[model samples]
Target: MPWSLHGGSHLPGCPGIMEEVDKILIRSLRLSGTEIPDEVQSIREFTTELIVESVVRCLRVINPSVGAGLSHILPPGMSARFRIGMSLAQACQDLGYQGEVGYQTFLYSSEPEIRRLLLFLVEKLPRDASEDASQPVGKSTTLHRAIAVAIKEQLAVPWVPPACRTPRLQLLQGSCLLKRFQAQPLVLPWESNLVPGKVPPERKEFFVKFLPPVSAQLPQTTSLVPSLLERNMAELSAAQDWESEWKSQGLGSRMTPEEYRQWKLQRLQRRLLDQLRQASPSLGPAQPGTTGRDLIQLLGSFGAGHERAGALAKGSRFTHTQNLAYKQEAEHPVQVETIPISRTSEQELREKQAAELETLEGELGRLVGQIGDLEGQMATLGLTLTQVEGEVRQRQLGVTEQEQTLRVKGRTVELLPDAENNMAKLQVVVESSAQRIIQLAAQWEKHRVPLTQEFRELKALHNSKELESSRRLLEIRELHERIRSAADEAKHKEDLYKQLLVELESLPKDVSRSAYTQRILEIVGNIRKQKEEITKILSDTRGLQKEINGLTGKLDRTFAVTDELVFKDAKRDEAVRKAYKYLAALHENCSQLIQTIEDTGTILREIRDLEEQIESETSKKTLSNLERILSDYRAMKQENTALLGRTRET
Candidate 1:
């Protein structure tokens, strides 16, 4: 149930979904020339090697730190193979696999289990942002991808144990990166104790006796801060280099200064907002209020004024024409006095003055409107300031209350050890505990008496039974050895029979051969019947022997009990003593008679077995073959003698 694909809902059960999973896994793992069946029923067509390699590759893709340490190939030795299986299973489990997992799950993998594991791994494969074909890759994205790849490559290498690692102390010690770029320890040279000729003797003694050296305080080799600082410095250097490059070349590459300035301003604003958000993530996106908008507009207006000034300076120059005109009027004062003024000109001058007065009144009204707007803005700011002040006062009050509570708790802790009432309560608790322990010990003794007796009795019984079982086990082992030997003998006889039959078939044929073959077949059939009868008789004998053994043991136990009872009574009466002696004699005689009967039965069984063996051997015609061989040898000797006599006579 745990192996059920919860995240991979579209996988395993359906053919289409399984196919998709298979294809994705194959492509991602680069399983070339491997074909997955279209039907789910045929999923087992996947070999163990293919499955292991695919799973290992998928794990690497998902989590290189764990997967990289595992071997893709199964090891030849059973123990090493088991270790690898366990490692892979553990790695999968560490990657949040909820399914049941063990070494057998990987080493002795089944189709359904493999399918589920593969689907899980495929689902966990890291998705690439560049997978979206619609979006073009940027330089930053490319750089980030390259970094990720490099890190993954580094992580994928299996780590060597510290004891097995090659020494690199010299390389690390002489490296410029460690000397120039490493973080320096935080020092307080200006402190009174550290300052030259200002350190107190007591302080120096404390430093030497109690405090560690500065190197130990902030270790450059092992401390996390140094590594972090080193990394930060590296990043800072890279950023500075990029900034300098941009200033020298990037700025000039732009079409105009205005465009560059606008881009720079936007970049700075974006960076400022990012910093603000990081500083206080709880505060979401900033809202553009009226005050902020007004400030932006004011800055824009100032920029526009500067642009206008630049344009004016580039276009035309200003001249002092008005000053020259005033000088000319002063020099021609006598001529102007001689000229007479008309009445019509005076009337036109009065009309012009009235129009000018109306325009001045309109301008004064506009200034009053601007003042009202400024006053309203000031009032809003005052309200905001009031709210902030109230929040600050509330925080201060909370801090003061916390401090007071801390002081009260501190005083209580300081006095708690010396409190007389508390000490008295502790003594009472200890006395009560001691009494409870004593009562429990007494109760335990009461329970332990009967339990100990029962345990001893059970232990004795267990030992007797164990002895009996051991005796039976040895008997069973002997029986097994007998059966194995019997089986081997039977097999050897069978082989001999087949070999003789083949030899007979290869021999020259004769008219009498048919009769001989028929006779031999009949003999073989009779031997088989005899063997069956012997087997049945042996089985029956074994059964009777078991019954005899049981009855004998029962009789011995009965006699022992009866004798014990009679003997106890015999000590009190002469009649009982006589009866006890008679009883012992009777048990002895009966045991002898039983033993005699068993011996007779064993002798009869052995006699029957011997008769059967003799019959089977005779049925094979062994004596007839031996007699014919003897006659042939005599005939050859006679012919040799006749040939020697003929040679002598010639």
Candidate 2:
């Protein structure tokens, strides 16, 4: 019904561009011009193409280098199409002939237009020009003729051209003003001579209620005069007959003698009934809707109308049915609702598990790596110890040879390996040094037992932690899997809840499904959140387990140093040993303290996360949402609170 086509031409360049897009849109849309008459469609297309073609034509005309523009003097009696073409050309030339076209050889040639504006004007117009430049010809005559033809053809009427005569408009000056008045017609009671007959007693009483109070009797006046009285008497007689014509007692409710007589008959009937009751008294029982019944029953019988009366006449009573029959026929109504969940819960669980598992495995691996490092250091220490032992053995063997040498030649040098008896002294010194080394090695061996024991204990602790961590990791993983499964199921239920929500949201206004859906959604959301939090705890537990395992490894390495303490050089190594022992003790204590802090921090964070989950899970939007979902789920249709004990025990 709305015409959207932009028929006026502001179309630029080739019309082909718009034509192409239009064709595509038209074809794609499968739009039909069936609603438009063939003539209008043809006209629309023709105008559109004409406008487009005209633009092209104007552009061709304006591009000329020397000739005057064709639009300068549009032909007299030109068609609208031709005029439109001329305007198009002039517009293309950018409001032609505005300021100046200076004779510049550099810009444009100065050759005058072969068909100049003056020549074209004189040729096109049906007027003669005056010598004075301002003197005018009848400029609008040609345009007027064209307009006359267009108006005649388009409007299908004889073209009555606008009058050229100078016209004046004035208000008519006169005193003929409309007076404000009301027309009152005296409608005489006897005007139409519709003198109505007396209404029956029953209808009169039925139609007119609230009878007038009884009034005291009144007297009439006497007449005077003789001949005047005689003439007056005849006139009075005529007037009395006329007065009967005008009289109307039907509009008034003052009872006539007949109506009064009927009312008195009704009272007489009531008194007769009472007298009969007193005399005989043993009557049949009264019935409803009979004359004996009260007015209210009569009205009520009519109020029920014919349908109920007919039903009662038919004797189709609604008697009690068997309890089993009632139960069998009664409807069993059931409602099913679902819960909602986050879409990414499954993926989140997986990601958490992945990261925590990586951390756990990484820590265990790192402990293994640390053990390798400790082994490397121990290997180097062992190699150097073996070298020291070898050198000490070689020197000790040389000392024995020297002692043998010293026994033969030096008693004094043999005593303490002094330099005096060189070989003997060297032998004794070598023996002493070897003995010190051996004793120290023995002490080192003694210390190695406890150190090894400590290391074994630490390793056992590490193994225990690792086993427990691994078990916990398995549990965490299983929990993750379970949570993932639960989460997925939760999501499934949640999706169902969302679907229910969408259905509920789409339900008719009066349906109870929305409240049911909202309640279910809240429950689902809480469960999903709880699942997510549980998954997170599993993730955190794995990571903390890894930290404990790492601490165990560190403890093992620290205890290992105690093995190096006991040696022949115990006195010399006392400070070094104590230092090592103190360092281990300090590291172990720090590890335990840090582990506890980190564990507690992790726990608190988890608790806070859970609390947030709880808050989010409970969507306390409106009072109804809260009451229907949480505070009182079963409450129905109540805007205000009910008595407390009225809640269902279930």
lDDT of each: 0.61, 0.45
Candidate 2 TM-score, true structure as reference:
0.15
Model 1 CA lDDT for position 23: 44
What is the per-residue lDDT of model 1 for residues 522-575, given as tens digits with 9 covering 90 to 100? Answer: 544654676698899999989988998899799889988998898899999999
The local distance difference test score of model 1 is 0.61
Q: Which candidate wins on lDDT?
A: 1
> Measured by C-alpha RMSD in angstroms, how accurate is candidate 2?
65.5
Tens-place lDDT digits, model 2, residues 1-650: 01112321122232343343233222211111112223332221322233223223323333444223333232322233345444443543362433222211101111122112212222222221111112222325435655877766646633332442222111112223333232222222121222247546664564455343212111111211223345445657876664343233311324554564456556665555455433322233234434334323333434433344221222211221232234433543223222234644667667766886786567556555665565567557756766897799899999999998888677754555545677676789899999999999999999999999999999999999878866775675577568768988988667656544544454356534355446445544654676698899999989989998897798677666654543333557777767766766786798799779989999999998888656534422234334434433333224223434466432
Question: Which residue segments of model 2 deviate by more than 4 Å?
Answer: 1-508, 512-515, 561-571, 591-650
- Which segments of model 1 are wrong by more than 4 Å? 1-17, 31-43, 129-139, 144-650
Q: Candidate 1, 387: how far from true, in Å? A: 54
